[model samples]
Target: MISKIELLNEIGIALSAEKNSQKVLELILDGAKKLTNADGGSLYTLNDKDELVFEIVSTDSLDIHMGGTTGQSIDFPPLPLHIEGHDNLSMVVTSAVLNDNTINIHDAYHADGFDFSGTRKFDENTGYRTKSLLTIPMKNHKADIIGVLQLINSTSIDTGVVVDFSSEDQKLAESLASQAAVALTNKKLIDEQKALFEAFIKLIATAIDEKSPYTGGHCKRLPELTMMIADACDKDDAGALKDFKMTEKDRYELMIAGWLHDCGKVTTPEYVIDKSTKLETIYDRINTVNARFEVLKRDAKISMLEKQMTARETADEQAFKDAERDYEALIEKLNDDKEFISVANVGGEYMAEDKQERVREIAKYKIDDCEEERCNFFNEDEIQNLTIAKGTLTNEERQVINNHIVVTIKMLDQLPFPKHLENVPEYAGGHHERMDGKGYPKGLTRDQMSWPARMMGIADIFEALTARDRPYKDGKKLSVCLDILGKMRLDNHIDPEIFDVFVREKVYMEYASEFLTPDQIDEVDHSKIPGFSGD
Candidate 1:
């Protein structure tokens, strides 16, 4: 008979490791098989619908493999549980899953005439005789059945001395099953939490999309690409990510940070967020430049006609035709490239009035009626909120865009988190803050931030600079993007020491390897990237 002390010792050993439900099951099955002097075993876990699902102790040798899922809605058939005693093992262990239902069976297989003919694998592989069996139902603290564990052919396992299933065998199997249930339950809870998190992200992204047609789904791609970058970061800096040791609390914090990172976008004005041109609010006024070209054309035509009339007085027709053709060619040249549109505003930085007025005059003839209406149709409150000026936005509009960090802090503050999640608010909020005081919304320097916050800061910026999904910008090639970030490091906008780690780790290249498409990666010159080498 296996002693209680040995069983408890093994249980403590199995549960000490972090996460992954399957390892715990393998431990239970292996431990029970050894304790009961049995040849082989399997663990069956019950799902939400009360359907059984096999966890581990598959058809091969029963060593533990972790992180596998027997989750969702898979079906598991019941084994022909041997009933040898007065008590019902299934009913008792139903408590493992159900939590309140417990059956304390003592001699689980004794008198119910348990059948062996229905058995499969243990005989198929071993080619050995199988006669006796012990079965026990797994129960949680609440007495619900999480799983059923069965030990086949109890005997002198090493010496091949055949023996019948003992009362000891039944007790041991029941104990192991109970432990397996708890592992299964925890795994299920984690899955449910993950699903809820994904749903919440979709909801928030949709709300951001609703604010402007131009940024219809910008926020949604940020988190996806953030995760993809994180994965690359992990691979490139596996040693570094491991140094973080990322506790369960750390994982939860990173998750919240990713979703809430762009909360600042909420405060940014839709027009500024969707601005398609340098001096754009209502009209681009590009047509003004075209109008100036048209006036030039008119002047050219008038001169040519006068010259033609004068020439007729002198009897010369070819010269007037040549002048007409030259004017058309001049207009065509002005039309191409259209003088790379520039506009002047009075609020933040004023554009030169002469240049501004000259462009405005050219646009006069091409101005559509709707263009005027959209220009003047500004909402008093929204305009006040946006702080847009004639030439550029007031300093206030820039602050509003930057206040997305503030919005993130405010929104995350409202979530009621479980214990130790207090840091979630700070970590998520601090993502945009520079290592130096250059970042907005509380420019607390390096010592004030946690390692997790620093990692997040790096992740957020790297994703943004390389990201292609923003309404106003195209994604940069890896070399150009990293060069900018590297310069920022030099400027104290980012951590200089961390930048070294970033280069040595080749974090950007590894990230781009996965994040950038085949054509996208191919477009960049590898050697030019600030921190990467061709070798």
Candidate 2:
């Protein structure tokens, strides 16, 4: 006679070992197989509707991954062998549902007119010896039947062949199920934690976008671009990145990096952040330039009348004619100037040195017969000393623009980032820095930069180079942007290795495909990504 002690010990062993569900299930099946000495066993876990979810095999795939369904979920409900006429497994399940304690039914397989819906699984696939079987409901302390545990080929341990279902084995089967209930509960908790973390990260990204009206699309676009680059790089090899298989850790890092890359912008002042033009504050220098052009026109008219008098080409003829034409032409060129042109240009946002000097020559010189200095020009020294090239502004206005990096760094420094995310503040702040130590907020150099910092640098340049929202500058075409970035790399303004990876992987194509606006997307020339095997 088997004692309750042995059954209690088996349940204790099953519950004590801590592991994931798959490993725990294997242990359960192993104990079942050993107690019954069956050829092998399968553990059937049910869904909420009592339907089979997974039929976990005790053996490995190498040990005959049966085709006709030895180790798969069944199409029909498997019938228990213990009761005839009524479905035996259904009766056993009903007992658990109602908390009934109906005991052992002998000669279950030999019951009259019995048919096995699971027979095809056994008789067709394995064809191993099978006869008597034992099954019992697996339940938790709450009396919920988590699943059913079964032992096949049950026999009198004293005898060599299969025999009737014994009372001792019945008690043991129920014990293992209780252990499985705990494992199920643990898995559910882990899934909930993972989902909560993902939602939290998305919330942070949304908060960053809310800071500035212009940046409402920034958080969304950056990740799209970052992932595109990763995808392009992924296509280069066998769906891996630099000898790594794009694991969960790598994906998590990229996602966090993309989201927090601009967290430093939180410190950036609102006015400077939205400073639409070079001469954005303290003065609308366009007004001042227009006023200067009027003075030039008035002086030109005087010069023309004087010329006419000197030539006896008579003042009466020249009086009504417009000598303001030459002055108008100069004003038009100053108001609508483009970048990277002659230093002899002026107006719009900034005044060139030569342009400032010429304006000074015209206005600053006393006519040798003036009343007061109503039209003095900005001297070259005063023009060179200010951040605003054309407009006059207080020191505070310029400081606000430079303080954006300071804001970004301060906000991120407060967050509790994982150790791997330690570089986020520095990486983000370094975007505005230049190669020649001319960049702001602690101008880091090539040697001081990390891969993440470099990634941020590239992403910043890429976005600004292609952005269509700047009031002072027109967006560049993709081809032009790429050429500019290539030159920046050549000029030591950007990291060479990163640029090499970008060109080799054709990274911009992936970014452009996703982040670029519809009009921009259509116009871009995308290079083919070489190794896009996302297996």
List candidate 2 segments past 4 Å from native: 1-180, 210-213, 224-247, 266-272, 275-453, 463-475, 517-535
Instruction: Score each candidate by Cα lDDT.
Output: 0.58, 0.55
Q: Across residues 59-141, which tens digit of lDDT does each residue of candidate 1 receive?
A: 22333232235343324454322335322234323323333322322233442432233343535655654456555667666
The superposed Cα distance between candidate 2 and the true structure at residue 48, in angstroms, equals 7.9
**Residue 125 in candidate 2 has what lDDT?**
74
| RMSD from true fold, candidate 1 | 8.1
Could you tell me how far off, in angstroms, the CA of residue 216 lies in candidate 2 after the best superposition?
Answer: 4.0
Model 2 TM: 0.57
Worst 10 residues of 2 by lDDT: 338-347
Off by over 4 Å in 1: 9-18, 47-51, 58-115, 118-125, 139-144, 156-160, 168-172, 179-183, 202-252, 266-269, 278-395, 419-422, 471-473, 517-535
Candidate maximizing TM-score:
1
1-535 in candidate 2: lDDT tens per residue? Answer: 2644565466556545544456566666666656545544456665664454334554322253221234444344543333444434344334433343423444444544334445435655765544565555666667666665655555555766666556656655655556665565565566587578667766776876676565666766666665555555544453223542344455556666677667656666665555554334444444554455456556656776565565455544444344445445655654443122222222234556665555445435322225655534443433433234543333566576567677777777887867755655665567667665656778777777655556667777888776765545555667777767777776777766556566667677677765666566434333422221212
